[model samples]
Target: MPQAVLDSPFGQMIMPALSRQIHANKRGGGILGIEQQTPGSSVKPQSQLHHPLAKVHVVSNLAQLDELLAKFQKSCAVIFFTSATCPPCKTLYPVYDDLAGEVGDKGVLIKVDTSQAFDVGSRFSISATPTFITFLKGQQENRWSGADPSALRGNVQLLVQMAWPPHPHQALNLPTFSNPNAEPVIFTKVPPLSKLLAKMGSTASDPAVQSIKTFIETRSSDGPAEATLPDIAAFTAIIRDSISTLPTDLLFTIVDLLRISLIDPRVSGYLAEEPSHRTVTAILAHVTGLPPKDCPYALRLVTLQMACNLFTSPLYPDQILGHPELRRLVTTLVSTSFLDGGHSSVRVAAASLLFNVALANSRRRRDGPGDVLPEEEQVELAASVLEAITQEEGSAEALEGMLLALGYLAYRMPLEGELADLLRAMEAGGLVLAKGRGLGGCDW
Candidate 1:
């Protein structure tokens, strides 16, 4: 029996007397042939186990029952239909409660006694006692009349499994492998969006900006209902021409707006599939600026964000990597920011961008006749990452990001190559020793 049943006011009045009788029977050498057990030596009851899940709600009225069902309407639910006079219900009560405790966040488990809530019984057309009804996303799924504990457990387990099936990749254990399905960065949090747009003044009324904004809103709300999206060439051209003339802070606003569209395949794919690759060209020119050093903090950060988001579609990064100039521009910007930027946040953002580049490159190599980074490119990036890591003083956040980027860059590189030579050089410089000491919890 459930502990709740034994703790009620009526139960409290009768349970002690019942327990004393049980104890007396045990002292009499057995109850149903079970041996007498001393206090504290008995088996731990299932009720005593920790069950962090929501408890089974015993609803007594139609309103309360409706409210309980409404709470988990979007999730899986199970209701134990019971009545006060049902003998099997009393037998199954503890089992149902235990199942609820085990169900946890996967679904909701509730109990309602038809004897107390006659209106609820009528609503569900309950004609029998101790019925179990299963619901998936507010719709009736399965129901049966009986109090078989194993069947109840099997059904609830199956419902939870259906709702949250295990991921296909969970069993694979590849430490350095990249997830090809990972989407690019989207700036979901638009703080003071109106203010940011207003900063552009009359330029906010530009058709390209308006089109980009509309596309973002539509994709967010309706999610690819349309067969077509805004023209990538037109949007990129407008932004490229405008970026050269915009103020530094406003540059961030434009890039921030543009990054959201990268999640749309129609838009991002244009940069990859177009023969001319005009959008990517515009991006590289805008990011590099007049002189590389002249790139504003806002532009650098937002461009890094854009670069990270480009990973949503492999084509963008793959296309950029195919072109020597574009690849050099991205590598230079990221390396400089990671190595020399005075701002810790900028370094961290740049490190993340580098990580994306390395991950994309690795994924491409694994897929076919692809190259992650050429031997020289790998060595160059690893050196820049190591320099940044060594110079980093106390920011664990930045250090961790740099270390991850380095891991991605070096994980699958040929052991006999330039990257390996670089690692050996780092060992000579005590970098390997520091890492070993750090892992062993020793002061470096």
Candidate 2:
């Protein structure tokens, strides 16, 4: 929770404004749509224990059980019907929870205390305690009456396998595509700060601007541990104020400064936590609003670089994926940049940003509850990547980046969605095969 500090002779000039801005934006709300709870202030509600993502959901009534079943209609589900006084049922509780955790988003597990939920017991015709039922795609697949842990585990595992069968491609001997690197491609090279700042001319003398320059220079040379952040609030305020007044040609200078500083997690984390995301929003909104043909190449390139750097903070992936306005702007920027044939560097940078976005969404699907990127956006990105690949006759680096980005987006996606259909319609497999032939032994 370290705030970015401003240290310079001009600190006095911006202190009052920064304080006022901070006080004005100070309001009670949670970050990333999750409410922040103070420790020891309140206990979590029992309802939260039954979250969709929780390992085991304890239903209180027939209605609650029905709702959960409806929500997971597309996946495997298991219902544990037990009585409070059933001694045998207690033995399988831990085993059931462990199985739920192992299943993750692939299936749902529900525990119903029939002793209290008499309606549910009646509805399901449960005459015996410790009865278990397995469901696949909403159909009753199997039923048994027991507290045997081995039986419960095996049945649930089998149900999950039935729900999501392994893709046939997994059996292929393509070692190159089996496990593509999940790491995001990032731009970390630091440019000469003194010379870079000189491009700003008189604006470089502004206290906020100078402080950011010092931060980037110190962090670049000595690393983040030795570098204290600049007053990000004040720096952001300056950028906001200058957007309307700064010449279009000169704006990239300030944006490049931010792009370099954002390489540090501390800097990017602060911006990500800002309630309005005003600074980052202002910069991207203005740049992307311009006609693609008229947008300055330097500004566009650095802006794309800054977007990639935002992924440095663990907080930002959620921000980029969950925030609708930000997600749209970023997707637009990336999709358009993919076809920027005039600038291979711009296309490469766009490919890297796309990879970061895909990598974030991929990890969410793998480790968390569900995908943050909507299917429509996924289809749009895949189409753009396909077009880029077909047109890519140069820059192996750019081509590789595009291929990786597409691979992540398509990874584990259900074969029934629009993304899959589009891939089929476009003959994506044939396209990739053609690209491979052109590359001639490129391991890809």
Note each model's CA RMSD in angstroms: 23.7, 15.9
Error of 2 at 102 (Å): 1.0
Each prediction's total of clashing residue pairs, residues at least 3 apart in sequence or on different chains, is: 1, 0
Best by TM-score: 2
> How big is the positional error of residue 152 in model 1, measured in Å on the Cα after superposition?
55
lDDT against the true structure, each candidate: 0.65, 0.76
**Which residue pairs does candidate 1 place in steric collision?**
184-312
Clash-forming residue pairs, model 2: none
User: lDDT of model 1 at residue 285?
Assistant: 65
At residue 22, what lDDT does model 1 achieve? 27
Which ranges of candidate 1 are over 4 A from the true structure? 1-174, 178-188, 226-228, 289-293, 370-372, 428-444
